[model samples]
Target chain A: MDVDICGPSIPTILGIASEQVHASSTGWSPIYVQDNFGVMSVGFMLPSSRDAIMWRGPKKNGLISQFLKDVDWGDLDYLLIDTPPGTSDEHLSIVQYLKESGIDGAVVITTPQEVALQDVRREIDFCRKVGIRVLGIVENMSGFVCPNCKNESQIFKPSTGGAKRLAEETGLEFLGAVPLDPRIGKSADFGVSFLDEYPDSPATTAYLDIIDRIKQLVD
Target chain B: MDVDICGPSIPTILGIASEQVHASSTGWSPIYVQDNFGVMSVGFMLPSSRDAIMWRGPKKNGLISQFLKDVDWGDLDYLLIDTPPGTSDEHLSIVQYLKESGIDGAVVITTPQEVALQDVRREIDFCRKVGIRVLGIVENMSGFVCPNCKNESQIFKPSTGGAKRLAEETGLEFLGAVPLDPRIGKSADFGVSFLDEYPDSPATTAYLDIIDRIKQLVD
Candidate 1:
């Protein structure tokens, strides 16, 4: 089934189509593009094997910008830029360059905690000042559920609906929370998305809803 | 043949004795330490199969201090430190830490060029400020032997005896010159000191003379 789309639907369709293409290229048939406007990722351009280049500062920034400008994006509806850790040169270069190249918006990911949340707020402020629309916030690692009691325990204490409060305080939409799951970490470690690995998992369900919200916001 | 003696030559004696111990530990015993006092190096602690943890900045500084403080000196004489490129944190941390730890002076390494020679003067100035004795300078990569003509070419374009010029300018002893040799790089690559690999080479002879001069300084 071949379908063409534009606008906010572009990122989702491109993500699905890219994954199917990648899977099929590795001689894996029966891989189909599903979810017309739902998926989001930055794994499409990564090498299948270990030829990963490691360098310091300016070198890393140069490589990332080269990827964005030179790589064939192939008609993206909404290009999502997944960033590396830390507020460093690479992060600064990517955010500013992407804005210049004209991105629809950005989804800021943060674990629920005072430390990280504070950093996230600064990043959001920076984005706004630079004229980039931040879609919303995704508060990951919100809480962990005890298997025996089925009661939720906050792993990073001093965090409960803080994302919501911040969103409300800042006049931005609150995208809810994602529970802490060991499986999510494991899936990422194995270079597969958690949603792709365990579609019915609680975390995946949360991500699906977030995607739906994004669709509504863009439409 | 194992020989051990103590005094101002403790680092040098330790270095010499370690050659025997390192030889005994490994079946092939080509590694020997000749104390060229004041010459800074991280090569002494490197095991046969590992690359020296050469990096830039505070981390590298920390590692140098650790190597000095933690490593077993045993019944050795002189401990020479081969510093990394420049007159910054790596060099400062090394000299200062060694002085604080009650170690001897520093041997500044430079080539016969105005640019490098100028930096060497600053390094000497830094050492004087920090109260580390200035032993002298070992001019390295001074010249190259022409492959076809067999005539030495000043490949590095040495400014007509840089060591002598620096010695006069800074009023410090000018040790000697180490001619530019491809074998030095080759030996370093193979984790063998150039002197150990090519003991009879002119470069090795220069190192031996430098060692003798170092012995005189320490004694």
Candidate 2:
């Protein structure tokens, strides 16, 4: 993946894949590189490997400890981790471990809905309690476009214009919203990045924008 | 099936296949029958058709709401709800919703492991916070009998004994421990009751003990 560094594009030095990444070369390379770069430092290996614990935690502080001590992550610009939804052992484990691991920031994802917004608020509170700064909120599945009507609708409804409201009330930076797109799910279902597959799609554009915003905040 | 009430043996209702019952009875009889006389109330219908929630939170709450209001549960001596593992969204949703839904109390299930125990403690705390009485704790998968060694090995290291220690320390009730039984999971998978299939099994005895304990507490 080519990440924009300033105006010029550079090959991604590291990538964080989801739990399903273990099956693919695209996900493995980041781990392989970090493994090979052991002499540089500690704590870098965590962002790279799709560790079994990374995908499963509630008391995964042990796994995160191993991640910090075992993997050699060279100095990098940013270490972004995409997390699974819902508060469980894995989610708590990751959050607690990240604070211990010295990661200072998080980007919480939510959709535009009262229920989801409430959950995101709780997530933000969780990050605050652990002393991790929430960089921003990314609203996914913001709105669905109708093919027949050429009108937008809330697939997850009563969520119309909720992202903006959430940002204002929570005092969090409004990163961006990703419109509901069928292609994103289709590509993600196969472990492929939708941005990589459909550069022109609105969802891909939103991801790029989010990536840009993430760089600005974390970089 | 037929639950014999007046026999020497206690009649345990494993589950009421309301769908099958309703289908067979031409839908004249309510799907949920409380005791043996009155019609089944709406408190008994579990939305068995919905896809398992991938995102967890709202969907889980939705399930709890459906279980509470939509199910036609008739008069019953005890209502036992089997919950999913961990303090994740599904677990939280049930706990929080049930706290407000006029539920009498809850039984915490745990394995004999530090990790699982930690989560169980969190759940107990959550129950306390929500003002839901902790009826007791059930330790599951405590010990496994080694086939070759013919010795009991604590594979999951049974949570009940440790739970008892924690209960001693915290003043919580240690209901009892259920040993690792392959038959329990097998019976559940096959949609049968372990108590029915293996009435003399140690696990079945434990389950009966649990119900007895629960009856004592809630009654």
Candidate 3:
């Protein structure tokens, strides 16, 4: 379920923004995606697309708790949560609520820039402080390929050697690097996955490789 | 001073991450930048570059209060705060603390994409709900220019007509649009303003125009 309450982009990203959430006798049911992936976001509850969620920390916590406890998430092997970028209230609330559910740890995402890495380092520290395992780091937007010339450009120059170097320093496993594919944004806007749309794209390969690593880690 | 506690990007953007905050008789002093712009961010107080701030709402509120009350701001013409994306705890805390100070209003920023505009509309609503004036909307990353071909590309594609259309729909003043410049990021990394570095850039001209409008509004 997508728990990034403030900016719940999952519905939009997955092209299921039109889908509505329905309440059952027990709790709220998530919008089903593909075969087995059921997704839920505060975006579904918004009045309009232009509406903003101007809520405080306690209110945010309340919504998060509802998503966790009130959602009838049937039997599932994985319930991946796309959290907002930070180790703030949302992270605390989620960890606290799911203390007994045995969360598999956090898979932090970051770009190859030092500015981004600096923030991500804190995320790893947060996981450790909260007794959550550090799954690994996935470097996104690592490089961009020019549509015209097909030449690769490091727009966000990896001054600090990207996440691999970070993994080495922090003793965390280096998952992989996902290059900047313009198609990725397009795919999100169109409500599809880059992997499904561009099956042969390098990003798709990278994602598959990352999934393999995750499977091994979980197993 | 940038009050976005969880993800304070000001220090990195200004290329002044190395500067440290010092305590004075009155309170904590802000890091002075070029042209007498005093800056303060939680990023300055971090132990290391990689250290993450895993704080909750109360702690964040405490820090925000300290930044406002304990900081030796002295007298200034403008004390612009670059808040994090969303109208959450930070926004509430800042507005609450600065209630007596007569905050001019909020100058909302967004890109020309439905995805971004959707969130910004809520921000405007937040300002209205909290009695904070809606200064206007500034569209950032409206377009990008290719260095090789020098052809402008609407990378984010203003599918929803961006802030101008948003302003038109909401009956609010449309500020202006700032084109996406690669140099902007580079300048931030190098600790300089794109306006100073690339004075001839379109972005610089747009910034000047925005400043003129802001002067007219505030004065």
- List the candidate 1 regions with Cα displacement exceeding 4 Å: A1-54, A159-161, B1-219
Give per-model TM-scores: 0.41, 0.43, 0.93
Specify the highest-lDDT model's number.
3
Per-residue lDDT for B50-130 in model 3, tens only? 666878888999999999989999888898988988878888899999999889988889977777777787888888888
DockQ top scorer: 3
lDDT to native, each model: 0.53, 0.52, 0.83
Report model 3's interface C-alpha RMSD after superposition on the true interface residues: 2.0
Enumerate residue pairs that collide in model 3. Answer: A52-B122, A122-B52
TM-score of 2: 0.43
What is residue A170's positional error in candidate 2, in angstroms? 43
* Fnat, 2 decimals, each candidate: 0.00, 0.00, 0.50
Model 3 misplacement above 4 A? none
Error of 2 at A193 (Å): 33
Which 10-residue window in model 2 chain B sums to the lowest lDDT? B3-12
**Backbone collision count in every prediction?**
21, 21, 2
